[model samples]
Target: MSGFLEGARCSECMDWGEKRNTIASIAAGILFFTGWWIIIDAAVIYPNMEEFNHSYHACGVIATIAFLMINAVSNGQVRGDSYSEGCLGQTGARIWLFIGFMLAFGSLIASMWILFGGYVAKEKPIVYPGIAVFFQNAFIFFGGLVFKFGRTEDLWQ
Candidate 1:
């Protein structure tokens, strides 16, 4: 945190940080959209999906909300600059970011639950729709984390 945030080092970091950040953002977007594509493909391909687990969709919804929350908070706010540097001037932003992470993790767990409990337990078809939902949430969770931490100076090293 010392040298990483220093002015001299930061100038060098800034030279490449923006490019790394953009690449990370693009990766996240690709993963997120790929997940949605899988889900949508399932819905369109298997129009007659019987006994569909509604909770699978719920996982995606929760992950989507978490993603939005994670993106809503500024990076400075997440680093507690709100309290120390009076940037955001409040601690609530940190709390919101924590809640967002929790939601993202919960969505992942819920997706696994659906995969095992609803699909695996019942011995569902080979191409189960639940798999798509699980993949969607998992991708979103990983992608969001990557996007969140990708800009950090430590990661560049």
Candidate 2:
């Protein structure tokens, strides 16, 4: 009975482990898509400078770039296990990852600044644009994080 129960438990764990990568990928993709979708909706609904400034889209663009940067380096490259030929090797990967994180954070902060400074602080605040900007950055940032750290690197092998 003990062995049977242990075997069942191990199988269950293995099943979940096998599915983890798919689950994480789906979640990250959903978050990224939803973020872009929200921004698109906001832009279409308020296509005028008076309602939504085109400048605000820059934050989402930066965040998208950051997302790509963050995911470009694999865990092994960052950890010095599978990469060691570049000018800086693992150190370079680490630095690139750091810069990516900085960009992500910077974009997110900029979005919040836009939200409060451009909309919330105004006398007659129009909030949808600001909220949309903030959520877009937030979702993209989180999605990048999920894609970067939520999966098992071993699964790729």
Candidate 3:
């Protein structure tokens, strides 16, 4: 416990410690959106796709978010090395994951809102395509900016 590494308990790791862990975190982020798009395109849109043009943009948004989550988590720790990264090690990862949540649950909630709004508003379907794309892309673009800059942070180094 006299040396720096000694005082540095696994709990002390600010995410993945800018080591091998970041790589794993990055992988998870990539997989997340990969799964996201597959689910969205195959499961959701594939079944109820009335708006491909809109859905396509939405898919891009999902992909962008997925990219950010992977990097964000990577900022904290590697996939298998999460234990050392500390509680907030996954902060970047989780933030990205939240964006992914927006991509997924956001749509569901919007649908519900639209359904309710349909009764009140003149629109019947209430499902808007642009909205989904807007959120997804916005998240991705912003997330990407952070990831791009944060890549050189000391936490990961």
Best by lDDT: 2
**TM-score of each candidate structure, all chains considered together:** 0.77, 0.93, 0.34
How does each model score on lDDT? 0.77, 0.93, 0.47
Question: Using alpha carbons, what is the TM-score of model 2?
Answer: 0.93
Alpha-carbon shift of residue 30 in model 2 (angstroms): 0.3
Instruction: Please report how far candidate 3 places residue 21 from its true position, in Å.
Output: 7.5
lDDT of 3 by residue, 27-86 (tens): 445544444454354335534445333335444544554554544454335433544765
The regions of model 1 sitting more than 4 angstroms off are 1-16, 49-51, 82-88, 152-157
Q: Cα RMSD (Å) between model 2 and the true structure?
A: 1.5
Please give the lDDT score at residue 49 for candidate 3.
45
> What's the true lDDT of residue 99 in model 1?
92
Model 3, 143: alpha-carbon shift in Å?
Answer: 3.6
Scored against the true structure, residue 89 in model 2 reaches a CA lDDT of 89
Full candidate order by TM-score, most accurate first: 2, 1, 3
If the candidates were sorted by their lDDT against the true structure, best first, what order would they fall in? 2, 1, 3
Across 36-143, the per-residue lDDT of candidate 2 in tens digits comes to 999999999999998899999999999999999999989888878883556678889999999999999999999999999998888435689889999999999999
**How big is the positional error of residue 141 in model 2, measured in Å on the Cα after superposition?**
0.4
The deviation in Å at residue 150 for candidate 1 is 1.1
